[model samples]
Each structure stands twice: as structure tokens, then as C-alpha cells.
Target: MTNTTKTILGLIIAILVVWGIYSILQKSSEPMANEPIKIGFIGPLTGDMATYGETEKNTIEIALEEINQSGELKRKLEVIYEDGKCSGKDAVTAAQKLINIDKVHIILGGLCSTETLGVAPLVESNKVILFSSLSSNPSISQAGDYIFRNSPSDSEFGRADAEFIVSQGIKRVAIITENTDYSQGVREIMKNIFQEKNIDIVADEIFNSGTKDFRTYLTKIKSVNPEAIYINPGGSAAVAGLIPKQIGELGIKNVKIFGNFLLGDKEALSVGGQAMEGIIFSDSKDLTQLSGSLIEKYKSKFEKDPAHDALVAARYDSVYIIKDAIKSCGNDDSDCIKNYLYDMPEYSGMIGSYKFDLNGDLLSEEFVIHKKIVDGVPQVIE
Candidate 1:
């Protein structure tokens, strides 16, 4: 063997040893990937809004597969799901179990406004970050510093719906919604917006959350002869699915029905049949602008079309955002995750660009898409 060859081999060995030590040190600095990263989930798993809950869970499950495959966090993800039932009291209990028993630092859930509000104080005080995909209450802006939602708030929805209504020359309307925070909060905002625009609200029917029959409220609104009827029935198909059929049965004609985003549901179609026709539903712009394989993939896996397509996108994007934050922070430290999110630039997600405003609300814009049921399907009109 020549001396020149031996010297070259020794140099190569020294470089390899140094690089290996650096690699080990880098890995040690990251959070342990062996143990699965646990993130708590709180949403209605069984209720009228249970369908929305299914979409949320399904999207996250799909995202977990992709996230784990990408190996971004170097850890497998494990979620502890607690049913919030889309109500405040139940949400509080779910939060207790998630924070106390599950001991999770990051929470993704509580799709209903009441659900998120119920858990916000508990999680915020404990420094746990609560990121909701669909809770759209405007009051959530001040709910807590740690609270954030990817979907545009009700304030945005209110503005869009109000503008769309007024544009249609609707000088008078009636609002019928449940007493739950989700329905009430959005209704309250739209009511105020309508008043500001000098639009008269002929009747406002607010009822308890569990009322399955709304024929009485519809009857009252019909008598008022308002140009339009706006209803937000909260998160159960029990109430929402009944509106269109009953409204048609009441012989209320010549009055357009404008509803919150929940009215875009497939159950509303299946339940109402031809009766649901011309029932206008307000939706987000991102839903229309979206272009991707998300829907196709969802259809292939779930064996049916998503009841709430926009919601599926929101929940799917949230998982990616959470995974990105976890990878960057190397740990599920609430403070770290919060800081990472606050500092995050606009994330081009499945639905649209996501950038948090100063108040932790999503800065994305929302516009009303006036869609109506046609031949048992919600179709956007010209």
C-alpha cells in the first residue's frame, strides 16, 4: 500500500466522524420522534352537527397519513378525540378531559361557537392553543389570546350576506335561529348590519337549541310577509333539515329564503327534495375558488360527496398548519406553537391563503355565494 492512498483514507475517515457527530447533535435537539405526538380533538361526534364532526375527523385522519409520510415532525401523530356535542357545557367537560387526562398542549376542535367558547378559557389559562376550523362567531375575536380559527369569522359572513341581501332589494326580512351561541352570534351580527343599512327586520324568532319543529316560527314569519326569511338552525340536521320542507308546507310563497352556510348541507336536499329548491345558502369564496384533488380524494375514500366541502378544506389545512408548527418548534410547547403561528406567513392551503390577523383571527376574505337547491342539489345560481 502507498503512503498517498493511506493519507487520503485517513482524511475521509476524519470528515465522516465529524459529520456523524453533527447529525447526532441535531437529532438530539429535536423532540423525540419515537413517541407519537398527541393532539387533543374536541368536536361534536354525535349530534345534529355530527356530520360536520365526521368531516373534521376524516380530514385530520387523511392529513395524518400525509403528514406522517412526509416525516416533517419525525413523530407519528396520535389524536385523543372528545365529543363536545356542539354545546358549551359538554365542551367544558371535553376540555377538562383533554387538558387534564390527555394532557395535550395543542387542541384542534370545537366546531361550534359555543363549543369553542366553553373550552377557550380553560385552555387559554393553561396556555393550551385552541385552533378551530369552523367556529365562526365574531365574539371569538376576544375570546382569548390563545384562541384562533382558520375559517373567516361571522363578522365576515354577516357583511357578505347583508350586502348580498340588500343588493337584491330586500328592505325587510325575518331571522329565525336557535339560542345556541353559533346561531345567535352570527344572527346578532347580521341583524346589526341590516339595521345599519336601514333594512327592517319584520320578525325575529329565537328558540332553544333542541327544538326540532320550527313550523310555528315559520308561520309567524310568513304572516309578517317579509321579503325574505333568514334562518340559522344551529348544528343539528334535526332542525336544519326540517326548515325547507316546513317552509314549503306553510304555503309561504313569493318570499326568498336566505340561510346561513349550514343550509348548503346535502341532508337539507335529501330531506327537502324538490321543496328545498330556491332556498338560498350563503357560502365562502374559497369554496368556489378552490381547485384541487381534495374533493376527488375525499369522494374516493369516504364513498360519498362531502356534506360541507369548505369545512373539509378548512380542517385539512389546519392539520397541515399544526404539523408544520410542531415540526418547527420540535415540541408541543403551547407557547412555542402560539409564537410559531403568530409569526407564520400566509400559508397557501387547500382552501385559500391563511394569515392570522393581529387578533389571531384569519385574515382571509369571505364572500357570499348565493346557492340554491336545484333538482335535489345545491347549485350556485347565475
Candidate 2:
């Protein structure tokens, strides 16, 4: 009697185990009705450029809310954020995790050019879409078909900066470049333009990335006694800011200071303080009526203004841009998303109306000169 009972119980247990395995398989095979489409974000959440990352993060959150609320997609969107810390090595690690572990077909970051360039190869090889909201290194244009950026390239930025310098009759200039993809790209293009226009580059100095003390570079720049000094740094607005402040601390007078787009950043303005007064730099001409409205919206929603309105707006647009592509081609098709972006018509958004070229670079953008510390606030000088 005991053997018979034990055998019957064992058979029952086996059947229950098999049924449980079948049920698990069935559940795994069927997609959840409300499953989210996961994407990846690689940016510097804790670095000198952390402000930029933080701003983009907040902007994306706003975009997601708007998109999700509108009910434009079959599934909700979710992001897995990885801090690249504005470092290439860190970005590569983040990219690997996003591509392999998270299995995300789309990524929305690497805000710094260093981070974008770092992850470019991995994304390209793996066929993941890497859409950078703010990285502007010209090299990114050729990174891969799957790579794109909403920000204008430094190629355009360099040309605008160079032309502005020439127009101002600034014949003699000193150029300081922080050795990183973004800064180096701008330096190269600007130098070439300066050479073509017969402008004198009296002192060309290069510094390693993340070098906090720019006093040595400033001293050399002072010694050159150029009519102007162009401060280009790849990492933080702080680097761009500290350079001018140091120039002032060195008593370098009568020199017009110039910088890239970042020179107008709030962090730069705060760090440079009075030293940034009358300093001219290039910025997106797209920062007009539309951007003003977005700024107000951001202020109202977040209870604070974005650090860089144009950049934050572009980050916000990137989310929508990806959203449209995902809607058109579905979330899993990286190739379709790439094609959709490449052939995307001129998209008008908070930043501006623009299209992508074959290389995924913005087809058009305009630059305008800005002066800082005009009555204690930045002013559009041109």
C-alpha cells in the first residue's frame, strides 16, 4: 500500500512540473500587452560636462512625457541611462552594456563628442542606432550610417567662428585647443579657414583633456599678444570659462577673446564672470522666437531655465525624432530607423527646421555672434 501511494504521488509531481515548464514557455513566447520599448542613454551624469548631461536628461524626460501622453506608440518608451562621464573609455563600456546586455536597438546620447566618438565603432558594428543630441565633432558625420546627431557639426561652427573673426578685422589670433575630438575638430577647421583667409594665428597651443589649470596656456597666449584668443575645450564649460578668467587674472588686456558655442554656456559665464565681458562667440542662429518659447516652457515646467536652451531643445527634439522613426519602422528595425532618418524631410521643431545629410549631419544651420556680460547678461551682439 505504501509503495503504490508513493508511486502515484511521484507521477503527479512529474506532471505538475511538466505543466509548470510548459506554462513558463508559453508566457515567455508571448509578448506582454504593455511591455515597454527600452532604449539607451550614454552621457556624462557626473563630470565637468555633467551640467550638459543633466540638462539633456531633464529635457528627455519632458519629451517622453509629452510623447507618452499623446499615445502615439503602441508601447511605452523607457530609457536605460549609463553615465559615460564624458570619457571615451567610459562611453565604450556604456555602449557595450547597452547593446549587448540591454539589447536596445536605439540609443539617445553620448552628449559629449568624446562619448559619441568612443561608442561609434561599437554601435556601427552592432548595427544599433546612436543618435546624439549634442555631440558635434565633425568626425561623427562619417562615424556610421547608424549614427546621427541633432546638434550642428563643429565644421559649420568653425567656419562661422573663423568668418566672424575675419569680419571683425582681427588679423592676429591665438588658438588654444583642448586635445579631444570636439576641440581638435574645431581647431583644425578654424585653422584651415584662418590660413585661407590669411589671418594670423600667432600662438597655437594644445592641452590634454581634463587639464584643470589653463594658466600655462593663458600665459603663453598672453605672450603672443595676439589681437584675439580663441578658447576651445572639449570637456566642460568650466574649461572654456576658466581659460578666460585666467587670462584676466594674468592681466592680459586689450585682447579680444573668442570661443566656440560653449563660451556662452551659463557655467562658462559664471566661471569667467567679468572676464567674459565683451567676449564674442558663435551660437546657433536658430535660437530665435521658437527657442524663446521653449525656454519659457522649460522654465514653467521645471521651475528653472535650461543651461543651454538650444542644446536642451535639440535633446528634446531627438526624442521626438526617434519616436517618429520608431513609429514609421517599428522599434526593432535599426536599418529602417536609419533609412527613415536619412530621408527625413526638413523637421521643424523647438530648435529649428533642418534635415539630415547623407552622413547624418545637419544639412543646414546658421550661426550668430554673441557677447557676454552686457549689463550683467549675455546679449546677441550680431
Candidate 3:
């Protein structure tokens, strides 16, 4: 071979090698849509708070369907659902399974406050991201850098409720809080605000999750006959049913009753029946901001009304936010998604436009929507 020919051959080989490596790197950087992106979900799918979890999953599924069908990303998404049972110990077990066994870099939930709090330390240590759907405990603000919740904070929800109650010109109210992070945190905030407004909390009652009977506390409140009764169900959907039933059976009346966000569920009507009627509550939702198409899609897919629960919006928005992060980051560096969300601009979604605060909680444009039960269902009121 001629010397010139040999030089040209070497140049061609070098170019081929460089081109091959470049192609591989590019392919790796942008994962194929066929590849599975595994995300974990830990929530109370089988315990007392199961229905809330079930509802959350419905929204998640709808979000996933829309996302996957859009051809938005190359990688397919898969969710591994684990039953957190709304207990910290159970949540810890579920978290271990998701992180160690399933090898998920991002988790969608630990829906209730207990599960989220339980998994926060582990996920933060393992460099995993946990984004909660409905955990409103204020303590979670200090849980970890990796812990973020889409739902409004307990302080925000509580203050909104307190302000609304005082605005009604009712000076005396009774309060009953369930023993849980969500209920306690919100209860404390409401108490402080009530104190600030000079409104008397005539009777205060605290109950545990499994406490079937609340007659003693209800009897006390009945005697006081406060202008209104404010009850925090503590993330217990079951309590929504039982409490109203007992309140009715006990013949406790002559005052308006109020509830937290959890009372907006249909369980209150199906289980509480006529007893659930006329109860008032405040929640972090401005329904006019929600997409009518999304609501219709949920009804069509699930064969039921979306109930407009804040958790549904929170979880639905969580999916889209993660999808956006993944698309922007383009690699499963986990840290990339964390940084993206840590500095994310206003994300316009089902829950309204949201930006992340330093604590990883969504700085959502959420307001307390005061509701009243008129005809076996909760209706938004002026």
C-alpha cells in the first residue's frame, strides 16, 4: 500500500471509533422510551385510610396515562405500589422494599403524614426523592432535603379554617382532633389563630385512630353547645363515616359542625347519611382552577366522580412535575430531578400554578374553600 493510502485508512478508523462512542453516549444520555422508569408508591391501600390511597392512585393512574400516551418521553413508566398502612413502621418496611428491592430512585408517595415521615430519613440518606401527595404535617418541613409534599401545609389549611370560622362572627366553637401528625399539627395552628382572634374554643376533644366511641367527648361538646363544632378526622376516611353516625345517634345538635379537608369525601354521605348533612368544613381547593376536562376524564375512566379532593389534585400534579423533571434532566441521576424541583419555576397544573419553597413543599396558589353539606353532599359556598 502507498504511504498516503495508509494515512487515510488510519484516519477513517479513528473517525469510526469516535463516532461509535459518541453514538453510545448519546443513546445512554437519552434513554429509549421503551426502557422502564420505575417509581415507587407507598400508601395506606388496605388499612383504615385505604380509600384515600385508592383515590390518590386513581389520579396518579390518570396522570400516567396522559403522560405515557403523549409520547412525551422515550422511557415507559412503571409504578410499584406498596401498602404503607398509614403506620410509620409499615411505611418503613414499604420504603425499604421500594428502595432496596425495586431500586426506585424517585417515589410518588407515602400518602398520609405517618408514612411520609417514616420514609423521609431513609430516602434522604439513600439519595432518593420522596414527594408526598397529602401529608400536611408541619414537622415534615424539617424532615429532610429530599422530602417534598405537593399538598398545602397544615399551618396554611388550619389558619384558613380559623379565619373563616371567625369571619362568620361565631365566637364560641368546639374542637375535636384525631391523634395523628396531620390532625395535631393543623389543630395547633387553628388553636393559635383562634386565640389570636379571641374566639373561645369551648370544648376540645382528642381521639385516637381506632377509638370507635367518641360519646364522652361529644357529650361534653353537646353540653357546651358551642356555636360550631370543628372536627379533624386525622386522615381517617373511616372516621368521617363513624363520627357523623355517632353524632346523629347521640342526638347531638343545635350547633353547626365543621370538618377538615378529609371530610369532603363521599364516605361522609354514604356512611353518615342524613347525619352528614349541614356539616361545614374548609379545604385548600379553588375548584375553578381545576381543569374540567381532567374531571371528566377521571369520571369516565374510574366510573365515579373525582370528589375534588385535594389529594387527587396533589397526586395528579406530582406525576406531571416528575415527568417534566425527568424530561429536562434526561438521565436517572436522581440528584438532577431533585435540583430541578428544588428550583422549579411555577408549574401550572391541576392544583393551580405551584413553585417549590426551600423546604421542598409546593408554594401552591391554594386557598381554603369553605363548604357546607346541603343534600347528602358537600357544596362550595360563599
Query: Per-prediction TM-score, please?
Result: 0.86, 0.88, 0.85
- Which candidate order results from sorting by lDDT in descending order? 2, 3, 1
List the lowest-lDDT window of 10 residues for candidate 2: 367-376
Tens-digit lDDT track for model 1 on 1-382? 7999999999999999999989976764565548788899999999777888888888888888888888777678888888998889999999998887667888998888889988988998999999998988888889888888888888887777777889899998998888877777778888888999899999999988777677888888989899998878776655666887888888989998888877777666677667777787778764534535887788889897766788888888888898889888988888988998988999888778868887788886554467776666677766
TM-score of 1: 0.86
Name the runs in model 3 displaced over 4 angstroms: 1-34, 248-251, 288-290, 305-309
- Worst-scoring 10-residue span by lDDT in model 1: 283-292
Q: RMSD (Cα, Å) of candidate 2? A: 4.9
**Candidate 3 on 1-382: residue-level lDDT in tens?**
9999999999999999999989976765665557789899988889677777788788888888888899798887778899999899999999999988677899988877888999999999999999997888898889999888888788888988888888889899999999888899989999999999899999989998788788888888889889998889885566877787888888887777788876767765687788888888887676445666677777888898754556677788899889999999985568999999999988887778778899998686555678888888778887
Q: State the RMSD for candidate 1.
A: 12.7
lDDT of 1: 0.82
Prediction 2 global C-alpha lDDT = 0.85
Q: By descending TM-score, how would the candidates be arranged?
A: 2, 1, 3
